[model samples]
Target: MPTVSMLDHLVLTVADLQATIRFYEDILGMRAVSFEPADGSTRWALSFGAQKINLHPADGPFDPKAALPAPGSADLCFLSDRDLDEWRQHLQAHEIRIEEGPVRRTGATGPILSLYLRDPDGNLIEVSNALHS
Candidate 1:
């Protein structure tokens, strides 16, 4: 049996593609790498270093409140540890909400600081840096 190695990407359907792209780019610092146009609409891809996040416009009328992910549920975590204070300032400057302990030490591994936040789509994302091996 082949074992699962790692996540490839995440696809989120949003009401506004541009707004979502902006959130990822401006707030998360991901780069808007590419987009595909089909039938007058488009699908876009954003990159955080090597990770890819794909965005597609919602197909029809939908309720955002009903579609949001449950609290405490996360779709992904983008690990980083470089200059966490700067990251916090960046989020605060943009009025983006953040969870507690962007500064906690990991119990399972060496010291690491983590910051958690949600995307426009309510997907949980984490940034952390490993302090040791």
Candidate 2:
């Protein structure tokens, strides 16, 4: 069996590629690294530190509708040692609606403070800071 090491990218089909790109770029601070032409459509890839996120056009003929992540759904967590309050302020300042938990010390893995939000395509993302040893 072949082994999987890490996630290279997450591809999301979005209703508006440019709007989604702006959310990820302007709001999340991701950088657009590349664009590719695929058949009659285009794909844009954004970089967040070591991860790459690919956004595909939702209007493509065969494109599937974006699914609502289930309650307590799949989440992507970005970790940092920075102040959690600062991150909360940054998201709020951008008018990004935060869902929950800048709630501190909620997990057994460590003492962490996190904020949750959904991207334009309805994917859940959590930005957190670990405070314990």
Best by TM-score: 2
Q: What lDDT tens digits, residue by residue, belong to model 1 across residues 8-120?
A: 87666666777878888898778887655454544478887667866655654223323652422345656664678888888899998887566665634567778888877
Question: Could you tell me which residue pairs clash in candidate 1?
Answer: 80-128, 80-129, 81-129, 102-114
What is the lDDT, from 0 to 100, of the residue 38 in candidate 2? 57
Instruction: Name the weakest run of 10 consecutive residues (lDDT summed) in model 1.
Output: 61-70
Superposed model 2: Cα runs more than 4 Å off: 37-42, 61-74, 104-111
Q: Over the full model, what C-alpha lDDT does candidate 1 score relative to the true structure?
A: 0.69
* Deviation (Å) of 74 in candidate 2: 6.1
Compute each candidate's TM-score over C-alphas.
0.70, 0.73
lDDT of 2 at 94: 90
Model 1 TM-score is: 0.70
* Candidate 2 C-alpha lDDT tens digits along 16-116: 77777798788778898766555455557889788886665656623443464222234577776667677778888998889997777555466777888
Candidate 1 residue-wise lDDT at 22: 89
